[model samples]
Target: LEVATPAVRREAKKNRRLKIVGARGNNLKNVTAEIPLGTFTAVTGVSGGGKSTFLIETLFKAASRRIMGSREHPADHDRIEGLEFLDKVIDIDQSPIGRTPRSNPATYTGAFTPIRDWFAGLPESKARGYQPGRFSFNVKGGRCEACQGDGVIKIEMHFLPDVYVTCDVCHGKRYNRETLDVLFKGKSIADVLDMTVEEGVDFFAAVPGVRDKLETLKQVGLGYIHVGQQATTLSGGEAQRIKLAKELSRKATGKTLYILDEPTTGLHFHDVAKLLEVLHELVDQGNTVVVIEHNLEVIKTADWVLDLGPEGGDGGGELVASGTPEDIIREKRSYTGQFLRELLERRPGGKREAAE
Candidate 1:
């Protein structure tokens, strides 16, 4: 499909870059790379082509150590520059946000706190003198004591795996009757948690804090997920996107550098489109996003491309091509460009014209 150029491309006058000089990390040769700030740049190549070695082992680790004071050392590299232009760096990976069942999108994104506060402000809560803590399922007061607020009871079986059944007391609602009694628009706290992110977006439209968080979740194509779905149930891509949503909702400093490795893994075509929109919006806000990607849709839309490897492993790690998609496609040696040329040519746009 025809992809629109990012707005950053139109105004890249100063051309500030994050330079990785003389990198020899893992399978990488003594390579040097320049990643432009405030653009969506993709690092692409064959498997084991040192994409990970160059970006993750070298760039991300080095940037983290220098900028955040992290002790993790980067792989062998001569020098890194232009880190001063960034105040923060985030690596959004596909790791679970929490290990326990109590963790969910609402809790991770901090929307649940405001949801509790809003519940506490209700007239029924005020009349009963119920504090915000009373609505918490994690605590004792308003939780279903029968299940210890897990909404389910786990029964141990020797030799057999543990079995869990819904709580008879609260009927898997997590909250006790008193907490459930405090309602907003006829829906209880449990009812709110049961709502999908898209449902919650409309349900809490009048509430700014809650609405904004739900909106971010929806923007990342997580509208179908329950507001309180267990973190353990989420796939890797879903978890990664949730992290992206949380970051998107935060106040942008316009100097944050976001790095992602294969974010499109396990995503549907529609979901990938949504992901791109969010990434480009970050660039529009003057934040730089560098992704190690192989997806054609993602590569086509990137403002810049860094194609590594004429081959994989021992034969790879050199910077085979580095430029716009147009520039990369013209380089005779770039395998990424050979494939990218077909994609860009299939659609009519400036990217396609440049490829021609």
Candidate 2:
């Protein structure tokens, strides 16, 4: 079983609802709510429904205070005004970046370090291989001297906005020809990086260490993701999964309190399942995952649901319903309950609704 540290356990033991009385933050109604710990909690509402304001302005604020020493416990006690219950909150939000010629996925999750070191440890490396440091594009030695290992170059566009073109000398390979000649199982470093996570999974399945992590990326609907794809080039959703992969790699000790904001932003219908697996793993490890999501599939999986909208704008912040998916569906007043009910009705013969 994944175990949280004694301190985390103690804090969780004291876990209770977050009380917001007369919250002055944006779009936040005089909200009074309680968010339970240990179980997966999904915060749901319509657009501009104070979801962001509540999670970021309140829970995240409390956690930040504790971490930065800007605030301390025992201020307003526990009923409201941000409490000590939320100590670990990681907010993953949207970012604008698709792909960058100079960047790739390796630099984001920190997986590149060990892989480079692994090659450096090879017998060939000891005989003729350069040090791990030298193999890095960030350094010299085996790097592409012409492009400085970035594989691309920035071009100044005269009489127009600045632009960049692929490096002419390196041909966007980002490695010297000699280094490209070194083969790991008949695949060059550039060749391996050029492969997507799906292809890389089969290619490196027997390589050990790196394979399992790469597989997770593939299962998460990132099969098209290149090993060397720059993070700066990734969509927000892709970057979140990369972050999830790193999070799952940690030894499960339930004390972690991860906060994810609309993690399903860019996913297609099929891709969400893969994301769910990652979240389930974290919860099974004993950590508390709090997500701000509008997706029905996510809220349906919740052990307990916290719906915070009677309506948006000045109407939200008051708790409309809090219970299981079944219970919420029974409540005529719940907005999410009504929407989910419609989904249930559309299915033939009252068939059960599927998780998104």
In angstroms, the error of model 1 at 169 is 3.2
- TM-score of model 1 vs. true structure: 0.93
Best by lDDT: 1
Determine the backbone clash count of candidate 1. Answer: 0
Expressed as tens digits, the lDDT of each residue in 218-281 for candidate 2 is 6666778898886556788987887777667656666667888989877887777678767766
Show where candidate 1 strays beyond 4 Å. Answer: 1-15, 154-164, 350-356
Candidate 1 overall lDDT versus native:
0.88
Prediction 2 global C-alpha lDDT: 0.67
Give the worst 10-residue stretch by lDDT in candidate 2.
1-10
Question: How close to the true structure is residue 34 of candidate 2, measured as C-alpha lDDT?
Answer: 62
